[model samples]
Target: MCISRRNESLNVAGTMRRGVCLAGCALLCAFSACTMGPNFDAPPAPRAERIEHGEPVADVMDAAGAAQRFSNDATLSRDWWTTFGSAAVDRAVTDALVANPTLASAQAALRESEDDMRAGAGVFYPQIDASFGASRQKYSPLRVGSGQPPVIFNLFTLSAQVSYALDIWGGERRSLEALRAQTDAQRHALAAAYLTLSANVVNTMIAYAAYGDEIAATREMIALVGEQVSVTHSQFTAGVAAYSAVLTLENEKATLEATVPALEQRREQAGNLLAALSGSMPSQWIAPEVSLENIVLPAVLPRAVSSELVRQRPDIRQAEAALHVASARIGVATANLFPSVTLTAGGGYGNRSMNALLSQTGQAWSAAADVTAPLFHGGTLWFERRAAIDAYDQARAVYDQVVLAAFEQVADTLRALENDAHTLDADARALATSEEALRLVQAEYEAGTVGYLSILVADAQRHQARIAWLQGVAQRLQDTVALYAALGGGWYGNADG
Candidate 1:
């Protein structure tokens, strides 16, 4: 009964010791939980409230019946390409988003950065390991002056150990912050990729339409020149017009014809570019026929505030994220100036005989604390910390540059559209006057009141006016598309979805 009581008493003492150990560990954790370093703060806003340029005019006077206006309250949809209301453009953008390797690459990079952040979070927990070993070795007691014989013995050891680095300096936290910021940067990069890809697809489609218009205009001019050549030949054969007039008509026809092949080649090149942007070979993809007439210009364009522009632009957001990462790295560097603390604990059971490995008498345990601090590294750490600060400053400058560029893009697009509207209006007027002049010259030539040269000049002027009008219309449409792209492609809040 006394032996049983003694064993119970030993058990109580062992439990008390373990309880004390756990309590001490808890106290240490509570005391060392604070991290040392500068906490992160968001960068300040720009001093200016509005953009450098004045606000654009509300409505533009277009030659076509469709007039476009700007509205400060207008908001762009997530799929801004759809605003053009062209099924072909929508399909091209959709297909590119699904199959473009560049977007897939960006997505993979974002996943990798997120995984790296997750891995860094592990620094908050303890590292635990279990080990087991068995060995046969010879030992001599004679070295201890016991005069014991040398003997071979079998030994076994089993242990589980845990070690934890206390984040008293907040180095791990700052490192994790940097990693998380990188993940954020990658996410923004992916959004930027999406924006770029969609814009390319839309821009390529617009160019294809422009090329088609030019080709059509060239064909019309060729037909008109052919008619003039036929008239000139008939008059020359009848001796009513000089042979030199016939020759001039023929030469003019040849000049107009020469432009057709170049226009066709340009059209084909634009088509090939569209195919490439769609992630298919030119031979495999059939580019859709597009024209400015089929595209609906957004009646009311969205013009965001300058500050909102900074928030919406993906490249600018990406640059800001990079700056955030640099700032966090400064904290990490500063934390390195402090000492690191680690706690270790281990327990094991062992015996020469495998059957007695778990015996109560064969158990062993240990606990320890350690500290390490860098004494010197030739000023590397100090300079690195300064370098981190400098890098952050650089990132901030780059972010500002990106914002400025984004605003510039919007301004350029707006001015182009405004100028295009005025040009289109003038082109329409010129074309009408040229057509009227051509009709009067044709009547006069038939009535023998004017020479064949007068008809040719009128026809050539009218053809040029027609081509100029087509080009002006196409340019206006392209600038409308550019405005959409400049405004962040309407993807600020919807990229993750």
Candidate 2:
């Protein structure tokens, strides 16, 4: 009989172990079940070899006479501003990245999203809570059909409870997924902010330098014209020329002088903008002097194909992340239409006497499983699911628009760079011709072979040509900066490190 009883106990123990194993397998299978929405796939990139459709982005012989080549497979550096070879430009970018309020706001947003995602992840695990209580109660047993006297008693309770809302339809998981995608979008947004701030700083600096150069060129022209006015005034006094000649030269000088204040104003505005970008008050900050001569045109500009640009550009990536978030929201809404399961278990000690609360007789335990199914919600769940689907469609459309805009911007910059090269070449030649003509005319006047009016006409032409050439140089540099920006400013490298 003892042997038979021991064998039966062994069989019962085996059955219990098998039951536990089966329960564990069932839980695992439930967790691995379908997530209730269409999985997201990234939109395929455009099937083009180059960004621009017409002539390839060719080497630009810019105003500085440097050949700026667009390399299809060049590794773009994170600190692209440094490629300008100006320490001042690099310093300004670094300072802006560190202190710009816009960038700081983006960083804070990213951190908040990340924290929310992490907090959302806790739903996958059981929620455990502990509680302790002490209270005085009056009990009346007569209500339970017993004629016992009413008694007042002290009750003490200590308990721990655990509850978990199982993600049977993956609603919670999908919610967490949406949070993660939103975090990703914010990260890309931060990158876009960095790109924009750096590009703005560099472009503004370029303008400041160009305006200063133009001001200098105008002053030199004014001096030359003033010299002519002195000579013409002497000639008028000697009765060798009309007084109108002196008036004409003086008028030209005054017109040239009038442009100086305007140029100075623009230069000051650019400086103030730079100070703001660097997170300093304009009155408290002075921008470093950046000369066009000190700025180096990038020799080999990095170019990405259409397929690569979608991935490189932060705006495109942010759009993709938004699409992902919308897709996940659809799953969450769809999951809400189905039943949700929750498992709860609690154990506690309770007693009228505080010292007896820990006794086995006072110990109690309970377990429960609950299933909540949506029955009648006035079609709210159904309409919500449809709305999520519509939102996903909207996100997809927006993503397509962002991608198209990115490609267009890149194409426009490429064309601008190419045209800038041709334009600068023409301007340089024009300036050179004007200078030669002025020199020749001045020499002829000294040799008594040409009239003073000839020199005046030549000087005016030289002044216009000089201004044009300076503008061309500045435009080429700024457009080079634009190309870098259009290519996403190499933020990926910075993000990785």
Write candidate 2's Cα lDDT for 226-315 as tens digits: 878888898899999999989988998899899999999999999999889989999988888878888888888876677678878899
Q: For model 1, name the residue pairs that clash.
A: 36-169
Which lDDT tens digits does candidate 1 get at residues 1-497? 99999999999999999999967754565487755455656555455654436774445545656688777778877798888899989988888888788888999999999999999999889999999999998999988888888989898889999999988767788899899889989988998899888888887787788778777777777777787778878888998878897787778778878888887888788788777777788898888888867777777887656756766777877888888888888888877876778999999998888899999888999999998888999999899889988998898888878877887888788778878888988999999999999899999999999887678678778879988887887778778878787887777843432
TM-score, candidate number 1: 0.85
- In order of appearance, the predictions have TM-scores of 0.85, 0.89
CA displacement after TM-score superposition, residue 121 of candidate 2 (Å): 0.7
Measured by lDDT, the strongest candidate is 2
Clashes of each: 1, 0
Provide the lDDT at 418 for model 1. 79
lDDT score of residue 90 within candidate 2? 85
